[model samples]
Each structure stands twice: as structure tokens, then as C-alpha cells.
Target: MLVLLAAVALTAGSVSAQTAPTQDRVLRQGQKGQGRMNMTPEQRADLQAQRLTKQLGLSADQATQVKSIALAEAQEMQSMRSNVMAGTDRRAAMQSMKATRDKYDTQLKAVLTPDQLTKYTQLREQQQERRQDGMENGKMKMKVKS
Candidate 1:
């Protein structure tokens, strides 16, 4: 029974991890820029709690539960990302990310209603597109400067 619960938590945790982005270090052109690594876990947790509470209009209990879920997910995702980054298997790393994402979506459906879930999906997609566009713009600027 304990093992079953652990397995369920692990599965849920992995899914949460995909939605939560733990800030990581990015190195480009031999210059390393640390992004979002200065904050400790507690700090990240607090901020995330605040954000989710505001965004989702979560009750106190819901906020606490979601924060706990997000933290576990973030830790697992961070570990997986680190492992993939340290090795040469980029394809495997991508597969891991996809699996994690799928798990996250599944868990979300269980937690949120169809309406809330739809809003959540839209928000996630917008965030992703914004991040991608920002990165692309940065690269373009770099090329122009060079």
C-alpha cells in the first residue's frame, strides 16, 4: 500500500514538475548566465504559492496543497533536467521531458474542472510562447550585433 501511494505521488509529482519551471543556469558562447538560481527552495515555494493563489483564486487549503505538489514536481523535473544535461543523450532527455509533460497534463485534469482546466491550458501555452519568443528575439539581437 505504501509502495502504491509512493508510486502515485511520484507520478503526480512528475506531472507537476512539467508545469513548474525551476530556474536553471544557461551557458552560451562560454559565458554562463545564472537564471533564477539565487532563490532558495523556500523562497521559490513562497513566491509560487502567492502567484497560484492570486491567479487561480485558490482557497487556503488548495493553495497549500498545490504549492506542495508543485515543489515536489519542480524538484523531480530539475533532477531529470540536470541528468540529461550532464549526458550526451539529448534525444532521451527530450523523451523524458515529453513524458513528464504528459504526466503533468493528466494530473491537472484530475485536479481542475473542465473550465478551470481550459483556462490553465491557455495560460500555460501563452507562457510557453512568450518564453520562446523572448529567446528567439535574444538570438536575433545577438546575430545582428555580431
Candidate 2:
């Protein structure tokens, strides 16, 4: 009887351990979103400036200016994100966000050279395509061939 009880307890313990992660997953799934968007403006600016430096081979002066631009945009975006999370209309909020993004793109264009602008445009298109391809849970939508 002692051996049988020990085996049963071990089995139950292992089963609970395996299921703990699944329970956490279910809890997250119940939330309305994927995760928090709480990056600080300085952090966001640094990351964006680094990406621009790598992609466009920007000068130090240009990277500094770009970081300033990114910081401003990040501050605005953080506000927008908070409002959206607070139950602002998602579609309207998105439109406002896009308008803000376009304004930032214009600011970036002013800082970039012509060649850099072309490369930036291409990069943005590629990013948009990638984003569209992977929206909602990493499931890629397939087009059916007629």
C-alpha cells in the first residue's frame, strides 16, 4: 500500500508540473492582447537609431538627429498606446497612429540622402509585407491558386 501511494503521488506531481505551463498559457489567452507595449522613449529611440545606422549607414550626426526624431515619435506613440489600451476605438486609434507614422517618415526623409531614402522606402515596404504576412498568431495565410 505504501509503494502504491508513492507511485500515485509521483504521477500526480509530474502531471501537475506539466500542466502548470498550459494553465499559464490559458490565462494569457484569456487576456485581450498579446503583451504590454511599455518601452521607454529613450530605449525606443536608441533601438530605432541603431537600425537606421545599420540599414542606411548613417553618419554620426545623422544618427544623432534620427535618434531625436525617434524619441519624439516614441513619446507620442506611448501616449497613443496607452489610450488604445484604455479602450479607445481600435480602428480610429490605428488611423491616428498611421498619420503620426507618416509624419515621422517625412521627418526621416528630410534627414536621409536621396539614395538612403530609396533604400529606406524599400526597407519599409519589405517590413510592411512581412508584417502583413505574419499578422495574428504567426499563421501565414496561403493564397489558393485557381
Candidate 3:
């Protein structure tokens, strides 16, 4: 009887040990330079122009010109990135991006009329401010969690 009881107790103990609750920890990390293809430059420019038109009350002609400039910039940037991005090289990628942006800005300035350019510049500044605000908010959320 004693041996039988010992065997049952040992079996139960082993079963419980095997089935004990374990916490699952999942660590999510952001992917570098992912999903750029999903967002086409035409779509980006259209969205930007739409926002600006609604917010700044731009004329139809100005909006159309801006969209064209944006599309051209997007195509040029794509070409630049294709030529430059190789291996795991990040600095080269950044330099190419900067060059493309500078050229795009020059093209945009040339394409837009003076009044339109003024509004466009203001819109660009607002976009930058919005992006900065979003980053700050994200950081605050992370800090709150930690």
C-alpha cells in the first residue's frame, strides 16, 4: 500500500511539473527599409497635394503642377536608389537620398510659380512639424510603457 501510494504521488508531481504555466514573451522589432514598394510616389504626391489643396486653398492649376513635380521627383528618387543601394551599405544610401531630395527641391522650385512656391514651402514646413510631432508622441508612448 505504501509503495502504491508513493508511485501515484510521484506520477502526479511529474505531471504537474511538466504542465506548469509558462509566460510567453514576444519581442517585436522594426524592420529596416521595408515596404517602400507598397507606397508609390504617385500616390504619395497625390495625397500630399490633396492635403495641401484642402488646407491651403490652392488653385487647381497650382495643385496639378505640384503633382507633376512630385511624380517626377518620385521617379528620379527611385532611379537614384536603384543605382546606389547595394549590400548592407547605409551611408551610401543616405547620401544618394540627400542628393535626390536636393535635386527634387530645385525642380519643384523651378516648376512652381512664385505664389504657389511660397505656399508649397509653408506646406513642407508643416509636414516636417507633423512628422516631428508624431515621433515625439511615439517616444512618449514607449517611455510610458517602460
lDDT of 1 by residue, 10-76 (tens): 9999999887645332112112223345544455555566665666677787677667766665666
What C-alpha lDDT values do all the predictions have? 0.65, 0.84, 0.68
The local lDDT score (0 to 100) that residue 21 gets in candidate 3 is: 50
Off by over 4 Å in 1: 1-35, 38-43, 139-146
- Give the least accurate 10-residue stretch of model 1, judged by summed lDDT: 24-33
In candidate 2, which residue pairs get closer than 3 Å at backbone N, Cα or C atoms, i.e. clash?
Answer: none
TM value for model 3: 0.52
Residue runs of model 3 more than 4 Å from their true location after superposition: 1-37, 80-88, 133-146
Query: What is the Cα-based TM-score of model 1?
Result: 0.58
Candidate 3 weakest ten by summed lDDT: 24-33
Per-residue lDDT of 19 in model 1: 74
Q: Which stretches of candidate 2 lie over 4 Å from their true place?
A: 1-36, 136-146
> Mind giving the per-residue lDDT tens digits that candidate 3 earns over 82-113?
76654546687778788878886887677566
Put down candidate 2 lDDT per residue, 25-142, tens digits, no spaces. Answer: 5434433233324446786687678778988999999999999999999999989999999999999999999999999989989999999999999998998787787775466556
